[model samples]
Target chain A: MADTSETAAAPRTHVSLQVNGTTREVDIEPRRTLLSVLRDDLSLTGAKPGCEMGNCGACTVLLDGEAVYSCLTLAVECTGREITTIEGLSASGELDPVQQAFIAHDALQCGFCTPGQILAMKALFATNPHPDDETIERAMSGNICRCGAYPKILAAARALAGTQAAQQ
Target chain B: MNTFEHVTVTDGNEAVKLLSERGGAAGETKIIAGGTDLLTLMNASLIAPQRLVNLKAARALRYLRFAEDGALHIGALATLADLERDAGVARRLPILVESVRDAATPQLRAMATVAGNLLQRPRCWYFRGAPHCWLKGGAECFARDGENKYHAIFGASSCVAVHPSDLAPALLALDAELLINGPSGVRTLPLAAFFHEPTNDARIEHTLAPDEVITEIRVPGQPEGANGAYLKMMDRQAWAFALASAAAQLSVEDGVIQQARIVLGGVATVPWRATQAEDALTGQQLTPELARTAAEAALAGAAPLAHNGYKVPLARELVRRAILRAGSVPHP
Candidate 1:
C-alpha cells in the first residue's frame, strides 16, 4: 500500500492461505495464479493446468466452499478463503464416498482428469447429496475427460447418489 | 504472461481513483473483477497491462438485490452462479437463469461476474492469439477474410468479431440499465446504447471510459405475465461459445402479441435487436406462419462473411423458435 503509483513490477504482497485445513504463507509475484502457486510452490500437483485458462477445469478447486477455476483465480485474491483440493478430500485416510464410487465404477481411464472430476463431484454432493442425471451433467461439464470415460463417470455419480438417498 | 504489479483496492472510490491514475492510454492499467476472462487474455499475452488493479477486496460491490421499485440491482461482482441460483431472480426472471445455465461450465460460472461477462473481449482467434488486429490498434481484421466461420454475420464493419456474452443479449431484451462510477462520478445509461459497433478510433466494444467501472446493473421488472426464452446453438453439446443465440420476450393479451423484444447474439458485433421482427409480432397471433415471417424479417439485412453464412439461417431459426418458446406455443 505504500507506493500507490509504482507502475513497474510492484513488490510482491505476502499472502496467507488456509489450504486444506493447514495454514501456508507465501511471498510470490502478484501475477501468479492460484493454480500455479498450488502446483509449483506448494507441491500440490493434484490440480493440473490443462488449459491455463478458464476453458479447462483441470485446475478446479473449492475456494471458500464453492468450486472455482483456480487457473482463472489470482493467488492474492484468495487471501482468507479456504481452499479444498483433491489431496484434501480424504482427511480421515479413508476413501471418500465419491472416490470409492469412482473406483467401484472405474470412472477414470488416463487419470489426468480424475482429480478435477472427483473434486467437482465432491462439491456437487456437498450441496446436493442426491443429484439427478441433468444436475450431475451440468455440474461436471467443466472438467473435460479426454479419455471419454463419461459413461463410467455417470455410473459412479449415480451410484453415489443412490447411496446418499438410501442413507437418507 | 508478462509480469506486472497487482494493486488490490478495498473500496470502489479507491479502485476508480487508482484506475484513473494508472489506467492510461492503450490499457496500461486494467481492472480485474473475476479474472475469468482477464486472466485468459493475459495468459495468451494478448494484453499486457503495466499494472493490474484487483478488486477482489472490494466486498461492497458483491451483491444481488431486488429494490423497492421492483428493479433488480446486481452489483458488478455478483457472479454468474449467484444469478443462476437466486430464488427471487429465478422466479421473476427465468430468462437470466437460462442465459447463464448454458454459458460456461459450473466452475466458470462460479468465477465469472456480471460486469466481467458484459465487458469480456471477443473469443476471436485472430484477436486473441494473433499479433495484431484492428481491435488491438492494428491495421486490419484477420477474421474478415480468413477462417471466418465463427465471425459476425450482421453489423460488422471493420471487424467481424461477435459479442461473446450470453448474458448481454438476455439483459438487453429486458431493457437493462448500467450504472458506471468514473472520474465524473456515477451516471446511468441504457444497456442498449451502451454497446456499439466498432468504430475507427474506438475499435473495442462498449463505450466505457478507461477509468470508468461498471458499479451496478438494474433491470426493471418485466411486464406482468410476460414470458421470455433464450436459445443458444453451440458448436458442441457442452462448454462452448454460441454459434448462434436468440433471446425473445413477449406479452400476450388474449392470444394476441401485445409487446415483443427480440435480440440475437453471436451474429453481430453487439447484441443485435431484431426490431423489424419485434414489430412484425406486435398485435399478431402466435402462429407458425407469423413466426416464419418474423424470422425472415430478423435476418433481412444479414451480410455474412466467408464460412459464416450458416449463422444467418441458424440465427433466423433460433429467433423463430425462441419467440414460439416464449409464447408457450407448441411446435406445429
Candidate 2:
C-alpha cells in the first residue's frame, strides 16, 4: 500500500491527456479531477464546477465523444481518451450549430450552465443527429439551469434538430 | 477529496492480488470503477482510502452478452448506459433496462458501472451530510428520529437509510449471481445472499470482502411466459432517487401465475425480497385484486419510522402496479 501516513508527502504521477485535438502533459496527484485540471491547469474555464459531486452538470464534457461529468472523472483515467471542452467546440473560430442555435434562440440568462449544456447537446448530436423532443429532454436533464432557461434551451435544440434532419 | 495513490490494474486477478498485498485494512484500499460513486463518497469525507485501484483498465471485464443457455452475463465494468442501450437486454429483461433508464442522469449512467451501482451506499441526508450518523460509525441514527420522509420502511435495524440503487431490486427479482475474485480464487454468490441489513456488529450493507473483486453478474434464464417490470415513485419526473420502487417478475401460463419474484428498493437497508408477496402471487390468477393482495402482503411487516409512514402505502401501490405491469393485466 502506498504510504498515506500523515508525514508522507502525496505522490504525483505524470499523465498525458488528449484534450481537444492536442496532447498535454501534467504531473499531478491522483485525486485531481478532470474538471480541476481543465480549469486550474489548462486554463479552460468554460466547464464550471457547480457540484463537485456528479449531481450538477456544470462540469459536463465529452470523453471520446460521449457526455460525462468531468467532476466525476479522474485525470489519470483520461489518458488516451479524446476530451472536448466548450473551448474546443469551435476551435476553428466558427461557432458550431448548437452554439449558434443557443444564441439564435436566446438560451441563456446567467450563462453558468450554457457551456455544459452546449457540450451535452453536442454529444447528443454526435450520437443521434436528429433527436426527438423526448431524446433532447432526456439528454439534457443532467444539465440544470437554475435560471429556468429550459424552454429556450429546448427551442435551440429543436431548431438544431430540424436543421440536422433537413441536411440529412 | 484527499489525495491518494492510484494504480491501474488490467485484470481482476491483478486487482485481487494488489488488494491482498497492499490493502492494509478492509476499507483502506478502494477499487475504483467509473469513479461515479466512490469519488462522491471521497469528496464527502465519508471514506478516505490510501490507494485507489483503478479498474477502468480492466478492459476484459467491460462486456454484456448472453450465454448459450439464454442466461445474461454482464461484466462488472459494464456501465449502466451499456445496459440501457443494449437491445438484447431490452428484449429479454426489460425490467433491468427500465430500472436504469432514469437512474440519476445520462452522465451518471454513462459513468456508473453495474457493480458500482449495486455497491453504492445510501443517500439519506443525515448519513450523507451529518458527521455523527450510525452508518458512518457514529453513535445514533439521526434519520430514525429526525426528518426521514425518504428513509426506509422495512428491515432497518441500526440504519434506516434505504438502498439507493434502482437496478438492485430489478436484479434481485431476476435472481442474479455475482462472480467474485479473491485471494482464494473465484466464487459465485447469489445476488440475494450478497446484501444484508446493517447490524451493530458489521455495520456494513454488503458481504463483499475487502480483497474480493466482482468480475461478472450472471442472470439466469427466465422460464417461458416470464415477464418483469420495475416501477419507481420519485419526488420528481426525473433525476431523483426513488422514494419507493418495486420490481416484479412473474411467469404465468394460461392466465395462472406459476411463479413470482417481488423485490422492493429504496425502502430497506438492502434490496428487499418480498417473499410473502411472491407467495401471495404464486399459483394465483392474474387479476388486479390479486396484485393488490400481493402488494399488501409485501408491506405487511413494514415498520415505518417517525416520518416515513407514507412510504408504506406508496411502496405497496408501487408493488401493485409492478405486478400488474409484469403480468400484463389491465389495471382496474
Best by TM-score: 2
lDDT of each residue in A84-116, candidate 1, tens digit only: 998898977987888999999999998988988
Q: What DockQ results for candidate 2?
A: 0.56
In candidate 2, which residue ranges exceed 4 Å CA deviation?
Answer: A1-8, A163-168, B22-24
Error of 2 at A5 (Å): 18
Residue B298 displacement in candidate 2 (angstroms)? 1.0
Best candidate according to DockQ: 2
Question: Which segments of candidate 1 are over 4 A away from where they belong?
Answer: A1-10, A163-168
lDDT of 2 by residue, A1-168 (tens): 112122347678899999999999998788888998898889999999897788889999999999999999999899999999999989999999999999999999999999999999999998897898899999999999999999989889888888534533
Model 2, span B190-283: residue lDDT tens: 9999998888887888989989999999999998999999999999877999999999999999999999999999988998999999999999
Q: What is the docking quality class of candidate 1?
A: medium
- Candidate 2, residue B114: CA error in Å? 0.1
How high is the lDDT of residue A154 in model 2?
A: 89
Evaluate model 2: give its TM-score: 0.96
